[model samples]
Target: MTGSHGLAAAQKGVQDSGNPTHFNFFRSALRGRQRVLWCANDPTVCLDREKNPWGGSTCCYQRFCKDTMSDPNHCGACGKTCAYGFVCCNGNCVDIQNDARNCGACFEECPGQSRCFYAMCDYGG
Candidate 1:
C-alpha cells in the first residue's frame, strides 16, 4: 500500500471491507507485498543503460550488452575477454587477422612459410 500502484488497491480494499471475504483478502494481501519493477528482468546480474547496477528499478536496460563491443573484459559477451596479444573481432579474439601463430582462429597456427592475410594462410607466398 506504500507504492503508487498499491494505493489504488488499498483504497479499493478499504471501501470493500464491509464484506467479510473482501476484508480478509485485503488483510492477507498486505502481508507479503513489495514494490518491484516487472520489466527490470534479472536485476541481480544485469546493468542498466546508465551503467548502474540494476536492482529491478525502472531506469534503463538497453545498454546491458552494449559494452561488449569495446570492453576487453566482455568483448563479445559478458565475462568474455580477449587473450594476451589478441584483439576482439566481431565477438572473437583474433591476432592480426594474418599472424602465423593465430591465422584464422585463436588456435590455428600456420605451417612452413605461409603468410596469413585476412584469416587465410597464403601458402603460395
Candidate 2:
C-alpha cells in the first residue's frame, strides 16, 4: 500500500475509526470484513515498510518510532524510537559505548565527536 506512516487499517480498507474488530492495543488484530491476519510479533509481516521521504523505501520505518528493524521507543514493541539518542542496538536501539554512530548519543555524544560504528556512532572520548 505505499507503506506510509499513520496509515491506519481504516484508510486501506475500513471506513471507520481504529476500533476494528480484531484490533488490539498490544497486538496486530484483523480489520474490516476482509480480515487478514499475519504474524503479530513482527510489524513487517503486516505493516508495509515505509518509503524514504527522499525516495525509494527506507531501511527502517518513516519515523524511527515505527520501524520494526531498529526502533527503541517501541523496542520490539510499537511506535517506538531507539530510546532517545540511541539507535537500534541488538534488535533494539540501545546505547552503544563503542558505537561510533551512537557512541556519545548513548554515553556522552556530540556531533563529529563520534564515528558511525556499523552505521551507529562511537563517541568514546
Candidate 3:
C-alpha cells in the first residue's frame, strides 16, 4: 500500500460534491497516518502548501506548472514557452534530434536531399 495501492485508496475515499472541490493530503507524524482536508471552491489554495499556501485560483494552474523542468509553457521559469514539436531540455527548448524542420538549431531545416539524423543533416543515400 505504498504506491498505486495507496493512491487508489485515496481516490476511492474522495467525495463527489459537484461544486469544484479541492483536497489536500498531509502526512502526519504518526507512521502510516495521513490527514485529508477538503476545501470549498476557493482560488487561493494549492496542492502543495510550500509552493503556494494562498494565492490566485485554480485558473492560475491552468496555464502554470509547478515543475519547470518539463513544462512546455514554463520550461525553466514562468513565461518561457517552447515552440511546437520542440521539447524542454535542461531549461531550454530544443528541437528533436531527427526533426526535419529544426535539425541542430532553431529553424535549421534539412535539405530535400538530406534527412536529419541525431541532430545532423545526413546526406547518405
Best by lDDT: 1
- lDDT (10s digit) by residue, model 1, range 21-99: 7657766687434322333455434344353333222222343323444445666666776888677655566675778
Comparison by lDDT, 1 against 3, better one: 1
TM-score of 3: 0.33
- Tens digits of lDDT, candidate 3, 1-125: 77999988866666333334344222223422322222334323334465453222212345332334555666666557888977766566877677767687657788886788888899355
lDDT of 2 by residue, 36-104 (tens): 333334434345434222111112333232334444644554555564556664346765645653454
Candidate 2 deviant stretches above 4 angstroms: 1-65, 97-125
- Where is model 3 poorest over a 10-residue stretch in terms of lDDT? 27-36
Poorly placed runs, candidate 3 (over 4 Å): 1-65, 98-125
**The candidate that achieves the highest TM-score relative to the unseen native structure:** 3
Instruction: Give me the displacement of residue 50 in model 1, in angstroms.
Output: 13
Name the runs in model 1 displaced over 4 angstroms.
1-66, 97-114, 117-125
Deviation in angstroms for 55 in model 1? 19
* Local distance difference test, each candidate: 0.57, 0.44, 0.55
Model 1 is weakest, by summed lDDT over 10 consecutive residues, at 52-61
* Residue 101, candidate 1: C-alpha displacement in angstroms: 14
